[model samples]
Target chain A: MEFVQNFPFICIILSMFSAIVSFILPGKAAKYLHIGMVTAVLVLSAGTLAYVAGTGESYTFMMGQFPAPWGNEIRVGVLEALMAVIFCIIMLLSVFGGIAHVEREIQRSRKNLFYILLDLLLASLLALIYTNDLFTAYVFIEINTIAACGLIIVKKEARTYVSAIRYMVMSLVGSGLFLIGLSLLYGITGHLLMTPAKEALEKIIAQGTYHVPLVVIMVLVVIGLGIKSGMYLFHTWIPDTYGYTTPTCSAILSSLVSKSYIFLMIKIFFRVVGFDSIISSHLVNIIFVLGLIGMIMGSVAAIKENDIRRMTAFSSVAQIGYIYMGIGLGTTAGVVAALFHIIVHGITKSQLFISIAGLSDVSDGKQDFHSLKGAGFRCKIAGAAYTAASLSMVGMPFFSGFVSKYLFASSAMTAGSGRLIAAWIVLGVSTILNTVYFMRTVITIYTPVDEEMRKVHGISPSKTEQAAMAAMILLNVVVGVASTPIIRALESGLAMFG
Target chain B: MDVIINMLRNHYQDIAAVFLFVIGMTNLLLQQNLIKKIIGLDIMDSAIYLFLASKGYIAGRTAPIVVDGITDVERYINPIPAGLVLTGIVVSVSVSALMMALTICLYREYHTLNLDEIMMKIRKEED
Candidate 1:
């Protein structure tokens, strides 16, 4: 076996090890430890991405002596490696951008605990990405939930406490449903491994037995993950959880944490139950209609929100709706578009959160539009970065968001007339709504304040924050302009998905 | 009635598990009290474990401990669901403990176990 095959397991173990090691270390040391760990994972995943993309083959690394149908295994392919690399990059940037807030907002005694949770969260996300076993994925989903809750509660405020519990309650419900679905799947297929489960499911489908149970399992798993990913109506916990938490936590939660569940759902479609079944089951139609509703309703809610953080949180609901909408199309082009939107939204949304954090810092630590007025001019770097991110979100040409929307539009063209028309209308209306709120935010931040308010001196962002913002903007533009290769990579990577 | 009776007779365990799941889900969604919500979550998790246990159990089969060194597959029920149930229990325990810890935090701040009351207090404080 090649040495690079070990990279996936090594990355998971290393992050877990860091979580444990950081628990014992002092806060300052743990911060540096996290940086070192992220950098290491970033490098390893980059190497793995290059190798996998070059070979164009997916490899399964056995976790024990048992082979395909038994024991544990993690499959790494071009898509998974690409996701890992980008996830690590975004994580490192989020930490870099939000560490100052962490130091300031959290009590000294609990600071290390924050990093511990971050490490565990990263480990769980990596495990979710790589694990081929349904049960292993469930375990990591629990770990992800717990670690994310700790991230919220680490700030030690009444609001954070309330929001954390709400988040926990919702997460537990989601995971519980997911577990029941997996157990039922096991009962039908008698296999926990994805490949074996797929084989069994195919046989069962051919035999045409247990049709009701199969559909029930599909709905359970999809809805479970949908709730976790903050799909539309299941997004009641989103705004408070994202708005009240520390900025870094919100950035990670909105971008990577919710995204992993969606990625896992996509994996299940391709690997376990099969996308053909997903389409044939008529579940995609329901997903399609819900996605359409969420796209309109989420944006409407965001428009109603006065607080900037809550606005972004609501925007996430709309973006998640777009991804599900693409999946609902149930075409290869549509799935690819959805995957591209994942990358685009992940990079663009994190950038928005991190930059907005900087913006609010210069505006008396306020997140409302009234206080954030003129914040852009005061904090030039944050302003530029925020503007760039907002432009991307608004789907302007020459931005990553535009590329994704374009992909979605073209993908919709290939669908049936009814779906194509619905997707187009929603896409058009959603884009308009996205422009309305995001551009309003941009304009508000750049709006001039009164002389007295202008006299309040704004502190320039620290060197690290400036750099993080620059890196994010650079990534956003690079993804937008040089998107051909990335899209091609996603297409080919998806080909090897199963 | 005949179809319902057949379903109840043949799939009693699954029906009961589904009933408990629905009840737990209802409580978790509708309950105003924090502790009751946690209890609801536990009930939901327990329902899943029971479902899994039922899936693993086979009538007239011994445990998978290999009694008298019997290696025959038919001598034991499927052990995968047992393992899955164990894992589910551990996850639920930790999650319930975390929920309880958060409940304590909420109680410390608001002096109430009702989520609605707490939300009202939070609104008052914010205003």
Candidate 2:
């Protein structure tokens, strides 16, 4: 029982251990070993969630047997635990999806490296979520970026290489800016501890000796993180990167990578900078405007895209906009909305990508709308899942997306940001536009094909693939129906802001 | 001119930092070659290091030291930014290595080091 309390860190260690073992194992053995490790992680995560929920208390473990203000502290508060739980659920689904897709799509020679980098990616994301130290967080972010780039290049496509390069360049610039911000912060405060840093910043601000250098540093930090999170105007790298990667990798990158950055943004803006102070300045308004532009531009671009993967990539850009919009509103509900949207959107987008992967399998590399004609009649389960998930993206009632959008809009109204409200209305129109494009694709999937074409395109997934698709579909359904309890849990976790 | 020189001497490190930054930005903007752009990034990064190092400088002060029977110790530069720069240097070197590998891959694929030519090839294939 006590061991279960330390399961989060244990899970991370186990992932890294499995990654090392996978390198030495043979191809067939490595695949099974990877599956076994992912399953163990899933069980461990479930048990940890149950234990945490039962105790209803936070726990902190300082790594290397050191105390705070000098040592690394891993806090498993309600928010951290909840996010961990979500991460585990998504990772589990991704594991199954990756297993099935990798077997068919990816070559056998690269299987070992694929599994190793995948596990490393998961471990780094977990580390990023759990660690309290800012410098340690930066290290984990770099690790995740490196592993993601490795995954991108596994396909060996020229476009994939180009996208990975762009991603790497942009990330370097972003991290450099983040370092500058951290340096300035340390200069002003003489400490790296977030609590002390915030106190020092507040004191400096209250003294009314506004320093231009400090302001410039803050702006640089915001822009840096904004680029990392794929916020508009700095989001040029996203569509190409996500569009070129394999569907399974795309799912992880879209669901996990951007959300991690958003989490950091929340930590910085709300906790470190203090939302009150940010709002007093014009930073909050700037974030709001950026979010609005992203929402409009991303949706419009998705509407015009012909490639299925590129369309989904653009959709992610728009979804990130919603998150920023929520945070930009600067109200309690808005914060809650942002957090909730991160979870819901993570599930929805991952499922969509997984479904696309399944569709590619059934359609034999035919991913465009025209070639997808009559796919629904062939792949019934995946078709139904895609339809439901797409409906959720359109903000249909009884789905997780609806609750998030409603909360976000209501929060903007309460915040008295009339411009934000107008932005939300425009976003609402964009959502409809999203529905129109997705429905067009869906209707084409159901449209009848000729006999010759049917015979040529007659392909179906194996039993394992069906099971994986079913698992993801069930998760989507369960999350949609059982969102209220999750929302309640999150509200309790976010009580600190109030 | 004498007054300006005196001011520059008083802030020699700042002037050096500004010069390095301008050089880096120029190289990054004007250089068509990828490796040169990366070198420019390093130059820009070094400028920041200079700035941080300069912030810790004080005139007429020796290195802060404590030894046996040595009670009077002069002020020394701040050690924090030096430590930070060490980490930053490691990060930059690793990034450059990755970029160099990526450049090799790009050359292998497109058979050219020219950015415009590589992009043209990609677009042609896409169309």
Candidate 3:
């Protein structure tokens, strides 16, 4: 019972150890091991969440014996606990949803390596979420990057290599900037721990000394993470990376990887710098404007894309922009809304990628929407799943997307004054743009075909896949319908953040 | 102006590090060859390491490891930055290796080390 205080470390080490062991196991055994590990972590994360929620308490675990100021530590509140649970659930669901394609795409021998990388990536992600020290965050960011690159090239194709190299280069640049920021901050503060750093920074700000360096640190870190997370202008690598990977890889990368970087960014914004300082420095303004651009640009790009996966990849950038916009509002409700959108978008986007694979199966692996005509009639489950996901993405009434969008818009509105009109107008335009592209793709899938074409194009999901897709769809609905309680929980969770 | 000059002179190692960082970043951004770009990556990382190590410098401080009967805290320079740089070096090595491997794969496929040429070939193939 008392051991649950150590659940954060337990979660991290469990995955790392599993990653090592999985590397030696056969692919089949590695997969089951993967499932078992994810399930165990999920159960533990749920228990932690329940404990945090019930008791309304947070836990901190100092790695080794050193105290937090001098050594590494992990702080977990309801937000961390809940994020861990959702992350594990998404990992399990996406892997399960896209397992058949994973087997089909990856070579027989290198399959276990994929799961191994997944384990390491998940471990690093948890570290990124829970770590209270800046240097630990940087180390895990590198691990996450390497593991993500490993995931991209696991299928071993010419396009994959190109995309992987681009991903590698861009990510290195981002982390380099991030490291520079940390170095500057550490130089000034002499502390890498979040709480102490904040104290140091607040004192620095209070004295109005070294104002320029503080702004540089803020901008550098924000831009570094912005690039890593595919915030508008820095998203050039995303389509190539997401589009070339297997659907499972795409699902994982799209749903988890960028999302985690953004989570860490939000963490730094709220916990380390404090929102008041952020608003004063006007860093959120830059995030806000770029987010608006990203929303419009991403949708326009998605509209022009021919390949289904590439289109969905672009849509993901736009969804990230939506989350960024929420953050830019610079209010507590805004952060909560953005976090809510993260969960909603994560589930919906992964489902769309998985469904894209299903759609491609019907068309004999051709990815162009024109080639996917009458796909809806042939693959009923994939068609329906895609429809549900697209509608939710487009913010149809009573779906998950609408709920988050509603929350986001209202929160943005609550930030009344000069930015209010711009927020509403941009939200309206992006929503309309989102509807245009998403509905175009949906209509293409549902377009009619002649009988001769229809008979030859049948593609059915296996029972497991059918169930997985259904579960994803159900998950979206559940999140939408259960927003009241979730929001309440998230509010309290966010209140405990600092 | 003289005081500012003195301050800059006092922190010349950091100025040099910043200069190296800019050169490395320009190489990374502007170089055509993938191999050159990788060297640029190494240089950039080294620049950061130099900056960090210099930041940890305290005049006349000894090594962080304690020896027999040496007890003053200020006698040793901060070791944390060195440790951090060590980790950064290892990560940079692996990343450069990965990038090199990717470059090899790319060269084998397209017979080019140039980004523009590779882009042309890839785009032509796509078309």
lDDT of each: 0.91, 0.76, 0.88
Clashing pairs in 3: none
Model 3: residue A170 alpha-carbon error in angstroms: 1.1
DockQ, all models: 0.88, 0.43, 0.76
lDDT of 3 by residue, A153-231 (tens): 9888888988898888789889999999999999999899998898988898889899898889999999889989999
Provide the global lDDT of candidate 1 against the true structure.
0.91
The all-Cα superposition gives candidate 1 an RMSD in Å to the true structure of 1.2
Interface RMSD of each: 0.7, 2.2, 0.9
RMSD after Cα superposition, model 2: 3.1
DockQ of the two-chain complex in candidate 2: 0.43
Query: Once superposed on the true structure, which residue ranges of model 3 sit more than 4 Å away at CA?
Result: A456-460, B1-4
TM-scores for chain A over all candidates: 0.98, 0.93, 0.98
Candidate 2 per-residue lDDT, tens place, A192-263, comes to: 655556777789888866567567666877887888879988888898888877777888898888898888
Work out the TM-score per prediction: 0.98, 0.91, 0.98
Best of the candidates, lDDT: 1
Models ranked on TM-score: 1, 3, 2
